[model samples]
Target chain A: EPEVTQTPSHQVTQMGQEVILRCVPISNHLYFYWYRQILGQKVEFLVSFYNNEISEKSEIFDDQFSVERPDGSNFTLKIRSTKLEDSAMYFCASSIMMGDPYFGPGTRLTVT
Target chain B: SQQGEEDPQALSIQEGENATMNCSYKTSINNLQWYRQNSGRGLVHLILIRSNEREKHSGRLRVTLDTSKKSSSLLITASRAADTASYFCATDNGSGYSTLTFGKGTMLLVSP
Candidate 1:
């Protein structure tokens, strides 16, 4: 079965540096989303995009965070200036419709 | 928070035993899905139970939903050592589009 895939399985960056996490969603999927999981916390929704614009977002998705589908299959999440608290497992998910979403192997981001 | 809450944060069982996890959510949901994550790995799509469906089965896994109770349960029968992982229940708050809230997952250890 086709699955979502992400690059740079693990990322380590200095505090205040910019970091971009990349994902390639399933080819036919239309809705894209980003979620994060702190080491021992629940998964938190960051943002969702469809029709080339953001459909919904959570408070956790603040000014420093942005998402872009630069091309057909690539969805990227960019953090303008990373903070130490930004370390977490970031997941990318996609779905053809509004129901179940297929998730990708997450990218673990660590800012020191 | 629209996120679900799972009980028994951790569980341990013999390889041949059955493992059960329960999830409870606060608001209305369009669908509920269960995913598994191995240590430091990806989220694996397990099973999805829709608002209209009461129970679903796939191989050794079974899931049941109670909309009125706003609760769901996942059962893994005849589990193996490979089943050791964290099981998460994710809910899509509504049907219009895709934004999910996930619970803090239950960690299961299947010992051989």
Candidate 2:
């Protein structure tokens, strides 16, 4: 079974630094998404991408966050400046269609 | 804002027992999906039930969706200690968008 894969399984960064979390979605998938979970909290939607553009985003996906599919397989989430609250497990997901989404193993971001 | 909320935040059951968790969503959805997460790990997709479908089963996992009630339930039969993990319910609002809003999740502790 083909699965979504993310790079830098864990990252530690300074509070004001930038961090880029990368994901390689399934080759044939047309839609991609990013979600985050604070420790002990529910998973929160960040953004969704299709046709190399952002299709939807949540309120939490504010000025600091941006997503890019720089290449055919790579989908990345960039945080311009990390805050302590940005520390969480960030997940990348993909789907052939909208109904069933497959998730990656996630990248744990730790900002201090 | 979260679209789904799961009931019984935590459950404790003995190995071999059946475990059930409920989820309620605020709006109409295209499909509802179940995922499991082990301690500090990535989410593993379990099953998905579409709005027009009432039930679906995969291996030891069973999921039922009640569109009229905007709710869903997940049942794990003959659960083992390996099943001890946090289970989440996610909803796709039929927008043709790939984003999934997840519930707070139910932590199940299957003791041996």
Candidate 3:
């Protein structure tokens, strides 16, 4: 069972600093997505990527957020400037046929 | 705007008992997916039912979708303590992409 993998299981950063969360989706998957869970809140969609461009994004994915598939295997989400509200558990997911999506363990981002 | 909303925010059951969680969505969707998330972890894909399909099953998990009513239910049979987690329903609103909007999850605690 190949699964999505994310780096830096947990991260702590300053409020004004930049943070880049990295994910390596399943090798053969064509669609990739990023979602966030704010502590006890529901998981929220951030962005979706396919064919090397963003397919969709949520309001939470504002000016500070950007996603890129810098290479064949890596999908990165960069926050230009972090805020306290940006602290959450970020998950990366991928699907092969737009059916069941497989998720990674997630990266917990903590901004202080 | 939240696309999905799950009912009965929390549930507790015995190991041998069955657990049922219901999900309701606000709009038409191409597919509905159920996911399980252990505390402090990312979501694990459970099952997916297309709008055209009424029911689906995998192992002890059964998922039913009623597109006309815009609702879905997830049933876990013969539960175990390991089944204690949060279950969420996500919907892809026929956007022709993989961006999923998720609802607040139902927390299940199965005591052994």
User: What TM-score is obtained for chain B in each of the predicted models?
Assistant: 0.96, 0.97, 0.97
Candidates' RMSD to native:
1.1, 1.1, 1.1
For each prediction in turn, the share of the native Cα contacts (below 8 Å between chains A and B) that it retains comes to 0.84, 0.93, 0.82
**TM-scores for all predictions:** 0.97, 0.97, 0.97
- Each candidate's DockQ: 0.84, 0.88, 0.80
For model 2, residues A1-112, the per-residue Cα lDDT tens digits are 8999999999999999999999999999999999999999999999999988999999999999999999788999999999999999999999987768789999999999
Instruction: List pairs with backbone clashes in candidate 1.
Output: none
Candidate 2, residue A4: the lDDT equals 94
Q: Residue B108's C-alpha lDDT in candidate 2? A: 99
| Model 3, span A1-112: residue lDDT tens | 7999998999999999999999999999999999999999999989888899998888899999999999899999999999999999999888886657789999999999
Pull out the clashing pairs in model 3. Answer: none
Per-residue lDDT value at B8 in model 2: 90
Alpha carbon lDDT of residue A30, candidate 2?
93
When 2 and 3 are scored with lDDT, the better candidate is 2
- Let me know the DockQ for model 2: 0.88
lDDT of 2 at B85: 97
- Give the DockQ-based CAPRI class for model 3: medium
Q: Candidate 3: where are CA atoms >4 Å away?
A: none
